[model samples]
Target: MKLSGIFSDGMVLQRNAQVILRGQCSVGGQTVQVVFREVITCTDADPSGNWEVQLEELAPGGPDELVITAGEEKLVLRDVLVGDVWVLAGQSNMELPVRRTLDRLAEEVRGLDLPMIRQFVVPQSYDFHGPRENLDSGAWVPATPEGLLGFSAAGFFFAKKIYERYGVPIGLIQTAVGGTPIEAWISEPTLRRIGGYEATLEQCKDDAYVQSTKQRDEDRNGQWYARLNEADTGLREGWHQAEGEAAGWSEFEVPGSWAGSELESLRGAVWFRKEIDVPVKMTVGEVQLALGTIVDADDTYVNGVLVGNTGYMYPPRRYTVPQGVLKPGKNTLAVRVITTHNTGSFVRDMPYKLKAGGQELDLRGPWKYRVGAVTEALEPQTFFHYMPAGNFNGMIAPLRRFPIAGVLWYQGESNTGQPAGYADRFQAMIQDWRETWGIGEFPVIAVQLANFGPEGEQYTDWAELREEQRKGLAVPRSALATAIDLGEYNDLHPQDKKTLGERLALSARRLAYGETELVASGPMFARMERQGDALRLHFTEVGGGLTTRDGNALQGFSVYGPDGTFVPAQAFIDGDTVVVRQEQLNPPVHVRYAWSNNPAKANLYNREGLAALPFTTEA
Candidate 1:
């Protein structure tokens, strides 16, 4: 006899619910007995070697053991707790670990010792055929300092808040992968019903086609990189070394994209060099070098030695410079960047400095750069794991038998490409999950797409995606946590996960824990009224009445008349309502707030400090 991998040591069973224990027996028709808290339950294995037994409702408390036996085979599960279990699902933002958020939330979790909070990191896998009966590999780990490094940042903070408030052991099932779209998380039947994904799914199912695509991608990438390395003059002449004079290099500003510059259309290897003067007092011990974030890949060298390197972007580039790497006088820093796809850029608004012994040296000025090698842009690879229903079948299906208190979803970045159909797809995925789990409408706290893209550049697609996410609130027992104010303009994965987690926990308190007295959400658009020449916009969930983030005039409001021309309008908060008007135009026929991709001026908020949801009053 053997139990499912999920039924193991350090696992948490759902409290106050009839949870099922599953396993397999070699001998068909053999009785499998389970014992927990003096309660014994038995079930016979079928011809397929599968056996299942249900336990009575268990209360919240444990560090207990579970015993199961069939014939001469016996398995024991130790240190199992009984409390709340939550499924954490989504794309990269949801999969981003606590290590990435350390720069922002380090102080909050410095000495945390919440062993009661545990997480089961589901190994990343995908399948095109059908749902998986069991996971290939996974284990339940507690929230120790070391283990917390791999825990999902958003999920960790949410679990921390819940455990602190209710004092119940929290179990998190992390099943998320980077760069995956919403359709990839839905079931095959649901995707077929929704349509538009049949062709991709069909293509993914063919073994030959998948193999050929992967092989082609490999060959293309290998050839491109090989040619670039061979033609790179910088490598032959030792451009990364400080001994080189670096002649024939042009001045380029740091922390900016190569777009609109001489290197805009080029795709290849580029080398950057910078000089800095260090004080003797600051070079006594090890120093910290932060290059913010880079696009694609980069290999950075301090002085003449390689200090650190990062493959691909998205993660902050932080490296530790040893004591011997720095000198008392002038030092040279060189970086070799490789642009595999898209534009090569050093993102703005991020830390670019060297810190040591409480001293800092800013590394954000013009640097001399030279083209090492130029080549064609690398062809994109087909990620089969991102195919529709692939992740759901392999990752989510295996966890269906496990009971969960609720779900925390932080996806939508990948689906912004086609924002129009996101609402239907999102709502359908929610319904599909509930039906598949055979659970009544459990609370679903979804995080709306946060602000992204360059400032002043209107990304209507992202705004439409946020609106689509907002529509998910129409489903019963669902909550939308507004994140417009919590996003970084340059970074897709924002560092302010603490505030986002707090917002999600607020919704969990109200919807899941029955804390109706709590204010869970920000101001939501209720209705629009045209009074005389101006328009009056009303709102719901005005916690403690309406207010503004900045104590200034209302912004991010626009109006359009019959001509369909939208102009910036002056707005003011009057009690719980906002009045908007544009003096130069006819009486406004439609209105919208914070509709831009990066609405830097959108400061409308409630007294609780939660930003108002972005919305438009059209149709």
Candidate 2:
């Protein structure tokens, strides 16, 4: 008898719930016998050669052996345990491996030796034909330095907390893909119920369109890169200054996107240069140059010397120049920004300075921009994995039989594009999964979107997205991990995953295990009461009452009057409620807090050290 890999040795069965063991046989109507501690079960294989047997709940300790027999084909599984199982699902933030965060969590990772905490990572795959029933292959692994390195950082830390607290085997099933939207995770049927995704779902089903598009993109990318390589002006004209500058370089605004200002619909390598007058005193030693941020990718140079290279747009641009690379009179900084796609440039509202010998130079305002080579537009990548129902078919469908405690989801960054009506779609997805699992109201803890993006007056996209996540509270047994205070201005993959994991466990403690007294979340804006000229905002889940993370005045509050214009408002704490008011506005129609893309310093948190989520009273 061939069995599913999850039913192999070293796997953990869910405690206090029926555990379903499954596999297949070549012959139909075969008798499948499963033997476990305090339980023995038998079942007949279906006509299609599929068989599954459910065992009664077992206690939380094990190093036990499990035996199964199907028509004289005997199999034995060793070192099995009974305990809580949780599925951690999301995008890159959820797929970030422990090794990626080793710089920060090294000390934490070294302490891991818990064999009780096992993990099973669903191999990343996508399917459009139909929802798949069985995974190709995967094996359960113990929590070790080598093993944990492949596991999700957030999931590992969360499992460590749960295993330590409960002293039970914890099974973490990590099924996530980076840069994927929520629609990709939901099943086709679920997407059908959610309307707006119908078009996307239908397109996913079109085999001709999918294959043709893929081929076209592949051919186009091959041509563009091949052509650019042959006629790279950046190399021919001595652009790197490190590689070497061309004459008459065009001028463009520094710390801004080049697509809108300097180059429109531009792709490929573009060289940037700025002349800085270094003082004689500061030139005695090496200096660190901060270029703020660059889009797509970049190779930076100082006085024609290679300093550093940064790939991608999310990280800040900081390169170190050698001591000899700088001179007293005039210093040249050349950066070759390589954006594979369209819309490339240096981002604004970031640190752009050169520091040396206790002296600093601001590298902002004007910089000469020149085209290295304008490559043909690269076709958008066909993300079959991000297509509707694709991930669920390949990753989630096989886990329908394994019972789980609950789900800890750290997604929604992919869904921010359609924040206005995501609540219904997300809720529909929750219901569909619950229905598929045949479990009633299993708890779900979703992390709210963290602060991000450049400085802007209005943050309609992400703010509305946070509101949708909050609106998920309308569902039963759901909690949210508000990460408003945890995001870095330049980095999308923030390194403070420990707090996020701990926070997720806090909610799981209350929802999944009935530890109801635990203050698992930050203050949530429950309702507002208009008192005189001010609005008194009441909150929910404020453990030990509300207080700012940094002990100071309340900030991030804004009020809009009858004219529907939002203005910064003065806010202060009063008992458990926060009273907000602005001198210029009266009879406030709406109030919002931390309602921007990157509310860099929006320090509104509860005494529990959890950041209060962004919210708006409007609609």
Best by TM-score: 1
- RMSD of each candidate relative to the true structure: 1.9, 5.8
lDDT of 2 by residue, 150-263 (tens): 778788888888887988999988899988888888888777766666777778788899889889888987887678766678767677673234358777888887655547
Q: Which sections of candidate 1 miss by over 4 Å?
A: 280-286, 327-330
User: Which candidate number maximizes lDDT?
Assistant: 1
Cα-based lDDT at residue 21, candidate 1: 82
Which 10-residue window of candidate 2 scores lowest in summed lDDT?
238-247
Model 1 has how many clashing residue pairs?
0
Q: TM-score for model 1?
A: 0.96
Off by over 4 Å in 2: 38-40, 46-48, 233-266, 270-294, 297-337, 342-372, 455-457
Per-residue lDDT of model 1, residues 436-551, tens digit only: 77768988899988888877796688888888988877888899998899889888899888898889999999999999988888899999998998999999889899988879
Model 2 residue-pair collision total: 5
Q: What is the TM-score of each candidate against the true structure?
A: 0.96, 0.82
Question: Residue 107 in model 1: shift from native, Å?
Answer: 1.5
Which pairs, if any, clash in model 2?
A: 238-244, 239-244, 241-244, 241-304, 242-304
- Compared with the true structure, the alpha-carbon lDDT of candidate 2 equals 0.82
